[model samples]
Target: MAYQVLARKYRPRRFADVAGQDHVTVTLMNALTQQRIAHGYIFSGHRGIGKTTIARILAAALNCRNPIGSELRPLAEPCEVCESCTEIRAGNAVDVIEIDAATNRGIDEIRELRDAARYRPSRDRYKIYILDEAHQITDAAFNALLKTLEEPPDHVIFMMATTQPEDIPQTVRSRCQHFSFHAVKLVDILGEIRAIAAHENVDTDEAALALLAEAGDGSMRDALSIMDQAIASAPVEDGRPRLVAQQIRELMGTVPNAVFERILQAVNDNNSAEVMTTANQLLDAGNSPAQLARQAVRYLRNSLIAKISGLTPESAEGGAAAELLQISPDEQRRAARTAALFTEEELTRFLQTMLRTFDELGYRQEQRFHFELGLLKLVHLRRLLPVEEVLSQLAGGGGGSAPRAQSAVRPVAAAPAPRPTAPAAPADTRPAFSPFADTPNRERFQGISVGHQPEPVPVAKTAPPVAAPLPVAPPVPVAPPVAVAAPVSPPPALGVPPVVAASPLATPPGAAQPVAAPVEVVSPFSAPSTPPPPVPAPAPIPVAPPAAVASPFSAPAPATPVAAPPAPAPSAPGEPASHLQDAVVDALSNAKQGSASDAIGDANFILDGDTLKIQTMLSKIMLGVVVNADAEKILRLAVRQAGGPVNITLLPADPAMKAAEKKAKAPRSGSAQAKAMEHPIVQRAQSLFQAEIRNVIDLRED
Candidate 1:
C-alpha cells in the first residue's frame, strides 16, 4: 500500500545476502558450526557496506535451532523457518538485544546491562547484545563493561559494529574478535542492480547501468536508491519504462561526453571564443558551475589514465569508458606517435591548471567568465614560454626568441641592474652646490677638493687683534651693590678633569674683574715619588727546573727518551689519550661503583653501530652518551671483552645502520674529511682500543 525506499527494501536479510564480505560471513558461520563462538564480537567497516546487517545475521545464526548444512560445516546457513531466525529477521526477537550505542552511551546503562547479563536467557539459545556504532560508547561505559566482557556469563553474547573502527579503544578490541567489512565492488554492485532491475521488469541500457554503477561509488544501498530514483523518473510511452543514457545524464546533471570532447578540442585549438560559447551553452543547459568544474577535472583525469594505460573504447572497462573518452585503436597508435609531442610533465601541468580552476570557481561569483579565462590561458600556455625559460634566456642562453618577441610587444619595465655606477660629472665653474652642503663638521670635506685651488695666506700674529673695547663714551650711572650673600664655593668636581686656561686679561680698576686661580693637573704617566727601603737584594733564589718538582708517582716524564718519530701507530694503540675515552671510563666507573650499571653493559653493547642505532638503544634506558666515539667503543668492547660470562649482548648491527655508516664513510670526490674518517667499521674498531682495556680489567675481575 505504501512505497518502501529501496535502501530499506533491499536490506540484507541473511549472511549470504551480504555483498563483498565473504571472509566475515564464512568465519562467523564456522564459529556457529564449531560452537566456539565468543561472548562478544565486533564488526567494522565503511557506511552502507553491511556492518550492522552482518551483526544481525550473526545474531540469528547464533540462536538458529534448525541450521542448514554445507560442505565445510553443518550450520553454515541458518534456516529462516526456525522461530529464532524468523524473529530476528523481523526485529522482534526476544533474546536478541539490539542497542544503538549512540543513544545509550552512559555508564549507568552499561552497568544495568552487566547486571542483567547474569540471568539466563528467557527463550533462546543465547542472549545477543548487538551494539551499533560501538565507537560512540562513552569512556565510562567501556570501563564499566570491561570486566563483564572479559569473563561474561555463558548465555550472553555481545556483537558490536562501528563504521570507524579506529575510534574504538584497544581494551575493547582485544576482548573480542574483529571482523572488517569492505565496500561492495562496482562489478558486484552492478550485478546486484541487474538482479533488482530484472525482478522489477525494468528495461535499462548497459551504458545507463554503467553510469549508475560509477555514481554509486562502491555502495550497494546508494546504488539501489539511485536506481529507484532513475526508474521512477523514466519517461513512459505506452506504459513502458524508457531508461536511457540521455535520461540518466539529465537526471544527474552531468555534461555529456560529446560536450567534454568539444571543450577539449577548443582548448587544444586555442580558441577563446569557442571556449566562452561552450561555457554559456552549458549554463543555458542548466548545468551548475560546480558540477561543470567537477566534470572537467574528471575529464582530464580520464585522459591521463587513457594516455597511461593505452586502453581503447572497445576494450575499456565499464566506469572507465563512461567517464573517459575511450581511445580508439587508431587513436592509441596516433597517441604513441604524438607521445613525444607532449611529455608527462606537460600533461601534469595541464591537469593541475584544471584543478586550480575548479578551486577558484568555488569562490568566484562569475564562474563562467573565470572558467572561460582559465581555459583560454591554458590553451595559450603552450604558445608562450614559461617564466623560467625567459629568465634563462635573459641569463644569456638566447633560447627565448619567440617568447621575447611576444613579451616585447607589450610595454614592460626593463630589469634593474644589480650594481649601477654613478654617472660622471661635467666640468662646471660656479661652485657645485649639493643639498647636503650644510654638513655639521668640516672634517667630512677633508678628502674632497674643489677644482679651483685658492692660495693659502700667511698668518699675522700679536696685534691685540684690534680689540673692540666696550664703547667708552656713554657711561650709565651704576646702582649701589646689593648685599647678596656670596655664592658658596662650588663643590669639588666629581672626577671631572681640571680645565686649563689659554690666556688671561685684566679688567679696568672700577670694572668687575674676574679672578684666576691655580689648578693642579694630573698626568697619567707620572708616578708618585716614594722613599725606597735600603735592603740588599737577597741572593737570587736558587731556581729549580720544572723537572725537579715531579714526584715519583707522577707519570714518568712522558719519555722524551726518543721521539720514535712519526711512524704510523699500531692498529690497536693502547688507550689513546682521548677526552671521550676519559669521559666514558669515568661514567662506567661511576655507574659500577654506585651499583647503577645493571643494564649499562647491555646498553653499551647495543650502541656499536651508527649514531641513530646508538641513540635508539640508549633512549630505551633513559641513558645516553655525551661522547660519540666513547659510546660506540663502550658498546663494542663491553660485548667483545665481557668474555661471554657477563650478561652483555651485542645486537647485530642493523642493516640500515650499516648502510648509513657506509654512506658516511664513503669517500666523497671533493670532500677532504671523507677520506680521513676511514671506513666506519675501521673507525669503530679504532675507537674500541681504550674501551677494550677497561672492559678486560673490569669484567675479567668480576
Candidate 2:
C-alpha cells in the first residue's frame, strides 16, 4: 500500500481525539446527546486545525448504527465498530457526501445540492453533505443555498467547513450553526510529533524535536508532516535513523540560534561591526535573508516578553512555543542581559522594524540589502544609559571618554560657570539720595544738592551790575583772577551755573579808598558808556558749613598791599585801541574765553572819543562773546593798554550817523521818547511799514 502523509494519516476521527479544541468538541457532544443538532452546521478555523475532521465526526455520530442507548435515548459517542462510522472514516459512505467547495462553488452546484436535499437517504437514517472551504462558495451560490440551508429535509444534515468564514454571505451564514477553531499550541504540536516519532521508532533528541516544533509555527498537521519528512531523510545509524538539531538546521537551511544571540548581544553592546559581520556570515552559510528577518522577529519578541515578564516560554506566550523552553544557559543569560538593554519603546521599534523588513523581503528583489540595512539600524541604536548613570558620568569628567551614548545628538554636559565678581564702591563716594544730606556732588545726582542755593546779594552803591550768562560755546579758558581778596560767595543753587566776579591787584599805596570809580571792565557789545548806576552795598555775606567751599556771598577778605598796580605807557593823543587789540586778544586767550577771543579776532577796532568800539557785520556773533565774563577781563586789559581807562562797545559795520545826528537835533529831556513817536516823519514811516510804536528816545538823554 502507498504511504499516506502524516497530515491525513493522523487525522482525528472522534471528537475526543481532537487536540486543544475542547470547546467545539464539548458543544458538539452535548448537542448530539441531546439530539438538538442544527441541520446547517459550519466550522471555521485556521487551515489544518480539524475543521473538516470535526465535520466528518459529526456525520458519523449522527448515523451510527450500534447505539449506546435505545429509541428515545440516543448516544453521543460513535461506535467505531459500526458500519456508519467505518464507512465515514473510509470516505465510502453512500449517504455521506463530501464536496470540495473550492471547485464546486458555482450557483448551479449549490442549486443541485439544494434539489438533492429533498430526497431521503439510501442506506443511512439521514443524508450528510459536507462542503469544505465553504467561504469559497460564490455569492450567488450562497444565496441559492439559503432556503434549503434554513429548512432542510428532516433526514438531511448539512455540515460546512472553511478556513475563512467571513467570506460567506451573512444570509447563508445566519441559516447555519457556526463554530470557530484556534491554532494548536506549540507544546501540543511538540507532544504530538514526539508520540508519532516514538510510534515510528525514529531516534531523535529533544532539541531536534524543538526545532521541528518551532518550524511548525503553530499547526499540529504541519508539525507531524515535518516530522514524517525529517524521519525519512534522517541519517541511518545501526539501521536506525539519527536525528539531531544540527542536521535539521542544515537540511532546513536555518540560521543558528547562536547567530541571532550574538547579533542581539551586539545590539546591546551597541557594536555595529559584530552585528553586521554575524549577519553576513549567516547569509554566506546559505541562510535566506527572509528567514533571518523572520527568526530575528521571534527572537526579539521573546526577549521583549522576557524583559516585561520573566524568562519562561510559558510566560512569554502561554507556553505556545516549545523551542523557547529549550534555550541554552548562555542563550538565557544573553537574552536576559539583552532584555535589560532595551526599553519597552526601543523593543517596540525593533520589532516594528523587523516585521517591516520581513514584509519587504518578499517585494524587494535584493533581499540582502534590506536585511543588512535593518540590522545596521538596530545596531546603531543609542547605548541607552540610565538617567542616574548619565548624570554620574557628567559629574565625573573621566567617564565620557568612552563611546558616546546618545541617539541623535551627543549629550554633552557643560561644567558650571564661575561666580561673577561684584564691583566695590567707596562708602564716602557713594551717592546720597537725601536732599538735606551735606554731601557735595551726590554721586548719583551729579553734584547737585538742595542746600546749594545761591545767596541773595545787596547791590553795592558803586560796584558794576553783574552781566547775564552767555549762550552755548566751545569750552573757554577761565581768566586767572589776580587772587581776588573778596569774600567767597555761596555756591549757586542746584541746576544753576556759577558766577565769578572780577578782582584785580592791590591799588597804589597813596590811592584813596574806592568811591566813585570809573565804570569797570566794559563789554565790547555794551551800548552804554558806563555801567548801570549802583544803588547800595551787598548784604552781609552768608555763612555755611566748613566742608563746603567758601560761600561766594561771604565778605571779602581785607586786601593787604601784595603788589603795586603797574603804570601803563602814555599813548599819543587820540591814539586808537587797535594797538590794544593784541593785548585784548592775549588777555582773552589767556583767560580761555574762546568764543569772545574768536569774535575779537574777527572784528576791526576803532577809537571813538574815550571809548573803543568793535565794528562787525553781525551783532549776534558777539552777543555771546560780549556777555562772557572772560570778555570783561579782555576789555579791562585793553583799557589799561591804550594808556588810559576807556569803555568798550560793539558797533555795526554800517553806523547810524544820520540817525545819531537827527536824534541830537530833536531830543528834549527824559520824556523825549513821547515827543519823538509824535514826529510827523515817524508817523509817515509807521503807516508806510504797517508798524506799531514800541519806544523812542533822544540819544543824549542818558
Best by TM-score: 2
TM-scores vs. true structure, each candidate:
0.50, 0.56
TM-score of 2: 0.56
lDDT of model 2 at position 583: 67
| Per-residue alpha-carbon lDDT of candidate 1 for residues 475-507, written as tens digits (9 for 90 to 100) | 223223211111111111112222221111112
Task: Assess candidate 1 and give its lDDT.
Answer: 0.57
lDDT for residue 678 in candidate 2, whole number 0-100: 77
Model 2: worst 10 consecutive residues (lDDT sum): 518-527
Runs with alpha carbons beyond 4 Å of true place in candidate 1: 67-75, 106-112, 317-343, 350-702
Report residue 453 deviation for candidate 1 (angstroms): 31
